[model samples]
Target: MAEVHGCNIPEDRYYWIEKHVWAKPEGDVVLVGLTDVAQSLAGKIIVVNLKSAGKTLARGKSGGTLESGKWVGSIPTPVAGEVIEVNGAVKANPGLVNEDPYGEGWLLKVKPSNWDEDAKALVTGETGVASYREKLEQDGIHCQK
Candidate 1:
């Protein structure tokens, strides 16, 4: 993991850095979640609303929405696919997103319909870390907690 400005960026997952989202490819499905930077910036999350399973989402579409003390925004899908499952734990306890954004707070599972094409646009490994670092620095943004 790369820690930039107090944000955790796991190298194992593909990142749509601009959206502050991560995608972890697991066989045919991808596990999606908000990045630590996002959760940190959002402050204490109070609510999470996710699209139900079987819902098809295009790349960059809003898969769900999150509300926090300081922010409220849609969670964009990094890969176009059918939502295979929603994280019940996150819905039940929005604080999980702030406490463990990359782990138990994962938003959903998606079986990508356009993996090859969509993946080409995501960044991962060392390159992803560097890219995220640059974006953070450029925007003067830092993670809190």
Candidate 2:
């Protein structure tokens, strides 16, 4: 799980450690979101700047933006892909990020151009949490969210 501040990380998703985003795969389709830890740290989200559906994104590039009280940052993608849908729920109620960061708060759905090549770099399962813990310690951040 993503142990940033003690939030529960969904076991099935893949994570981008640096960006703190999660990617849930469904065949060629992928769902994206800020990890539980990321959302908790961000505090309240006032607004989200989402890329349009059908927009093509490159691997490791920012797919959209999250404007929270804590910091304004880009949400990165693991795979180069075409976005199929942007979360309407989050658009209307930005606070959903805080309420359910891993589920209904999901930001987008994508059709990755290359799943295998891109997914290779992501962290999963227990190793993912270990990796996140190292990063948190390196940043001198304490987590109990």
lDDT of all predictions, in order shown?
A: 0.95, 0.82
lDDT tens digits by residue: candidate 1, 101-137: 9899999999999898998999999999999999999
Candidate that scores best on lDDT:
1
Cα RMSD (angstroms) for every candidate in the order listed = 0.6, 1.8
Q: What stretches of model 2 exceed 4 Å from their correct place? A: 1-4, 143-145
Off by over 4 Å in 1: none
lDDT at position 101, candidate 2: 84
Q: Quick one: best TM-score, which candidate?
A: 1
Q: What tens-digit string does per-residue lDDT give for candidate 2 at 1-145?
A: 4445566766688889788888889877998888877787788888887889989999878888888877898888777899999998898999998888887899989999988888899988888777777877787655334
How much is 112 displaced in model 1, in angstroms? 0.3
Query: What lDDT does model 1 reach?
Result: 0.95
Q: Give all TM-scores, in the order shown.
A: 0.98, 0.89
